[model samples]
Target: MAGQAGRSAGFNKEDLSSYEYKKILCKKDEIKTLEDKTSHVSDYELCEETVNDFYTKFRTNHDTLKLKCDNENGSKCCRDVNYYLDHATGIFKSSILNDSDKNKLIKIVEEIWEPNLRAKDIYICERQTDLDSTRKRSILQHLHDLKEDEDYILSYTKDYNNHLKEKWEKIISYTDSKPSSLFVKIENNSMGIVENYKNFLDSSDYICGNNLNDLSAHDIKISTDMDDFLTTISLDKISLNVEKNLCFNKRYVDMLKYKASNLQRINNALSIGVAVLGVLLIFIFLYEFSPLGRFLRRRTKKQIEVDENANDEIPDSYENSENGIPYISYHSTSH
Candidate 1:
């Protein structure tokens, strides 16, 4: 009984209120939740979202910078990250990032982009009908890796469109007139190649069978009147593919965009560089006429005087000679 009382009193020191105790518990819970989240260090979606959000901030700032600040010759490339690192890291002015750390970050960014590269490559994925044990193993392996019921696997393997079975058999089990080199491995969207439409000409079934359609379009719906035409393709794959690829190939195809931005940065570094350069250039151009330039002059005459005075004590010195001719040889006898 005494031990129980002591344990109870530990949290309720000095008659602590219920609210305070509850708040303390909640804080502990919050810390535990944060720890759990941090454990998933390889959460790709979370990392991608963070990068996209930060990029949005950078873009907003850049656009505002373009409007507010005016300097010539590619002030545009201030945040341009083509082949390198954080150009925007000037705010910290210090970096503890080592080579290994940078490489690690590059690898992470590449992981984020791997699916995109794969998806582009996957477009050219023509069905490799010449399935040895390898292709069969690859297909079966990926299918089994998915933890789903029999119905789910059947849905993909058998046919979503019951109409797919007939033509698919011919393509899947046929002589190799020409076999495709592209192999797709979408283990959560990080695999495949580009270059197709001709190869899968007759075999739309095999292309779509990969739980993905890249080389061929499988659906076509025509109206009874023959005046209406419609195409229904599984947009889910396309949309996810688009997200990964960022419309790399078809940028202009779906270029129309509308966005809302309340991008307000409370600081002013926009004109810092421009204003400094402008001021410095102006000073440079008008410097010679300014009073300060007198001190900055070459001091040719003063230098010459110093040179003469320096040589005055030396009898053989040319500057101290009668002719004052530089590089002239003269001989004189001293008393």
Candidate 2:
């Protein structure tokens, strides 16, 4: 029973209430200091009476203040306070006010809040009430600054347009001094070249089997129109010259072919003659070295010697008949 009594004595409700009272007093002193820093109109003692008075005024003018402060800046300020109060409570909720004095203000306001009214609603109402008088003045200042910016932009645009117009006039004047015929001819040639190039690119299948990368400069055939324009002013003259040159080239090639054929025939005849001469020489060599050839030479030599001897013998016989003429005459007389 003594231990129970001692335990009961140790737990004192009055001690807890005294500590809370001291804390509230310290916060009230801080609130008073914060109030001294704020505007005179917003200054108020941090007490239950002051909080109640402010709440009463806010509730009475809530609709009118909300309507007056219905712009983005005012709404954003109100929403910031509302959002802060919604997620926070107790002493920590005071930290949501970034300003040193604002923390004290919020702390005091939160302390005296009624159970029926939410902290978020009360904070939003307070911000709206404060914004009522300054909303119109701020909007007017924004309009004045916007008008100045617009005027400067208009002046800059006008100057830029004038500069562009002057440049365009100079360009036109310079172009007017140049000869139109030269430009016209150049433009026509350029257009023809572009058209020919386009056609050449489009005809990929015929160019080189649709593989453009493999195509060489020699593989590309220039369009006749483009060729004529680049090579000469008169297409007919170019065509006539080309035709004449082609005819001359064809005649020259035919002459070359005829000369080649004649040369080939002459070579063949010379080769055949050489072959016949070589065969004849071979036969003569064989005949001269053979036994039959030697035998024929000896027989011809013997026949020549026999003929000479017969001639000599006939001469001797005639001489002898002359010498013995007397005896011969007597014999012929008797006959």
Candidate 3:
């Protein structure tokens, strides 16, 4: 018995070892899956961080460029221009500028660089070696070219400034003229006789047809006088009080038109409803008197009679008959 028990104990030890080995293998697979998931998450986070950094740099550079360009008297603009020119080949490779912004930047760079290039050429010519006669001649030629380029730059700058000034003046004039334009619109809208009548109806305390007709004659006279005034008056002649009155008149006129339109729609809806109701009554009357309707009614009555007869013939009970056998009554026809 002792030897047999020893053999069983050895078998139990082998089984437990195999089970632990399988459990360890499962745990290793789980750890590997977790590591893969963590690696993917890290990669995504790194990509997002890179995108944010790119946008931040792009915005910073864009703002810096704007500030540098806006400061005409500062050396920073020159430095920025030089930097961008040096990097011009790789500038559009980034997402820093879209098509329109890139075009504007190119134009600005051209304006800055062309004048600067003239000055640079002049400086280079002045610093050239005087030992070589050929170099001296080349320097003289560069100086002449520099003088011509400077003259061209000056003329172009003047034309650009004048163009900007004209644009600014036009913008200022347009800004100043907006109120007058609005006033003109209001005046034209309010000075109409039909609009005046509508406005009077909308503004009146009572909104009935009688009140509408009663106010018409006075409004017509006022509208005619207002129209004459508007035709004779210039936009500049309109005072604050006149503008306010015109605006009020326009507001009231719009409200009146809205209300009148709504009323017209309501009237149309009511007329349609009445017509529909009349047609429905006519249909009901025709249905009651029509031969087809009478035939349907007769059919329905016959169906009800058949149902009643069927119900009457159904046996109320299956009681025993006189011979003591259960009797079921099924109505039958005899020929």
For candidate 3, write residues 224-254 as lDDT tens digits. Answer: 3333433333233233333321223444355
- TM-scores of the models, in the order given: 0.19, 0.20, 0.23
Candidate 1 local lDDT, 183-247, one digit each (tens): 22222231222222112222222222233223122122212221121121222343455344221
lDDT of 3 at 201: 18
Q: Judge candidate 1 against the unseen true structure and give its global Cα lDDT, from 0 to 1.
A: 0.30
Candidate 1 at 130: error in angstroms? 24
TM-score ranking of the models: 3, 2, 1
The lDDT for every candidate, in the order shown, is 0.30, 0.34, 0.34
After TM-score superposition, what is the CA distance of residue 83 in candidate 1 from its true location, in Å? 42
lDDT against true structure, model 3: 0.34
| Clash-forming residue pairs, model 2 | none
Worst 10 residues of 2 by lDDT: 182-191
| Residues 130-234, model 2: lDDT tens digits | 222222222222222223233332434433233223212221222223312111111111011112222111121111112222222222222224323333222
